[model samples]
Target: MQETRVAVAGTSFPAVRQHLEEMLPGAVVEAVPVELLRSGGCAAEVLVPAMCRIDAAVIDRVDGLRLIHQWGAGLDGVDIEAASRRGVLVANVPAGVGGNAESVAEWCVMAAIAVNRRLPVLQRVLRSGAAWGDPPGRSLHGRTAGIVGLGGIGQALALRLRPFGMRVLGVRRREDAELAGRLGLAWIGGAAQLPELLRQSDCLFLCLPLTEATRRLIDERALALLPAGACVVNAGRGGVVDQAALVRALESGRLGGAALDVFEQEPLDPASPLADRPDVLATPHIAGVTDSSYRGIARRVIENIHRLHDGRPLLDCVNADPAGAQASRDS
Candidate 1:
């Protein structure tokens, strides 16, 4: 039998090569830079794309390539339509936040409390050595937290919120069959209920996807529904909330505050109004990305490669194709 040749595409960290070599014994794996994974000269049975682009035509070069293992959850870079048409199995690792949800949830809760109590103003007084009485901070012990797009991250967040003694109201496209039995979580209808959920929720945490229907889902009209003191945390796609409208609401004091991780424009423009807002706590999209999350890319790649070589089920196959996987099945 001929030896199986696999190409490792897109590098994560320097140690990935050593770890992968030890995991797959006897497998002839070539660690090539992401730019060269698709070069015609490569004879890889399996192509693991880390940061490599898998456009519609990427598969043409690797006529004998079997699988395309991805490093991250979002497959926007990978051309699913082209790969699905060409019969290539694309894999991803959602990784379930790997305890990242707790940190993110903690950040969101802190932002909410920070604004609710007007801690920034109090901090100013404290810095100047001025005395101040209790700032009006609401207790999170019994507030309602509305969670949108109840997916892996959403579920992770909801579970963590349980200890806070908060009422968790979920506004999703449909009821999660898995969390259906869980108490404290009440499914509050569809997108129509977003306004009402906003009115009722003390804090709204959005963990949604970016789809055509979901674009601007939290625009101006939705912002008007929230009570004056309601807070928002968008850990989801930024397109879900309208930035311009959000800034206006924050400026007018119609909305309490916001904690935004992702934004419509990544590496957010310096002059954006939200950046200077005292009520806004904006992070550089670091909610789910950690060293552990980075390793997830490599681990998922190894798992997908093993699945393809062993003829087992491919995990996170976003681009599911037959020939793309079977091309090297015989080899």
Candidate 2:
């Protein structure tokens, strides 16, 4: 029996390695860094990484590349159009609720509370032993929350926000979302409903994917629609929000503040304006990492591979083609 030959485009942490070992007992695994990938000298049939940008030139360089698997759900880094032309299969593991929903919701919720209650302002006053911080604050109860992209994460947010007694307005594909009705989401009319949602929402949470349609969905016009002192919470792709626009909104007091877990540029530079803003709270995109989420990630990746290897249906296939590379016999 010939074992499957595989390669890793490197991973962020060790749990990915352990899961890969458990999933593929005899397959060869090489954790090559991005520089090695750029060199175009290494040999591998599969490449998995947290973020790997595979363009037409890189695809040309990969002599015998078959599949590129993104460790997480987003595939913005991979050139899907070029990959489709080249017949290279790409996969993303967004199958069974990528554990990001709850964690990201938590961050957004915390941000809303922190900003509404002026927690950061109070902290500064406390440190200086100043008298009576008098920043106006709002309560979550009876407030409106606009959740964009009512997918896994958005649905989870709706569920979580319900306990707060807040009214939730959802904008999604507008197709029949069976789960949306089941979850009791008050469906907004259309994407055009965006302005109305922003106008009414005390906190606007973005849970959308970054597509051509959704990129910078919250631009100047969108930000201008928000009620005064409203907060913006982005847990999805950072490209969904225009960074410059957000900063301007914050500076102009058009928005009270923003809580961000992901960014347009990751591992944000200390010198970045967003980092320096006392009003903004930012996290380094760790909203979906925990021992449990790791296990969930492992299970989804392994199951998909199992389906592919055993002539079964591929679960959570992100790439246009799943078998564009090398197809193996059933195990």
Going through the candidates in the order shown, the clash numbers are 2, 0
TM-scores for all predictions: 0.73, 0.84
Residues 1-331, model 2: lDDT tens digits: 2355556664455567676777678876676666776775466666666554667766666656656676667788888778767766677777235575666666677777877777767777778877874666778899889998877777777888888889888877664456657877666546867777888888999988899999999998899989988899888899999999999999998788888888988758888899867688777777666666667776776666566555554565555433433343222
Residue pairs whose backbone atoms clash in candidate 1: 87-321, 87-324
lDDT for position 97 in model 2: 57
Runs in model 1 lying further than 4 Å from the true structure: 1-72, 85-88, 95-107, 114-137, 175-183, 291-297, 309-311, 322-330
Alpha-carbon local distance difference test for all models: 0.69, 0.74
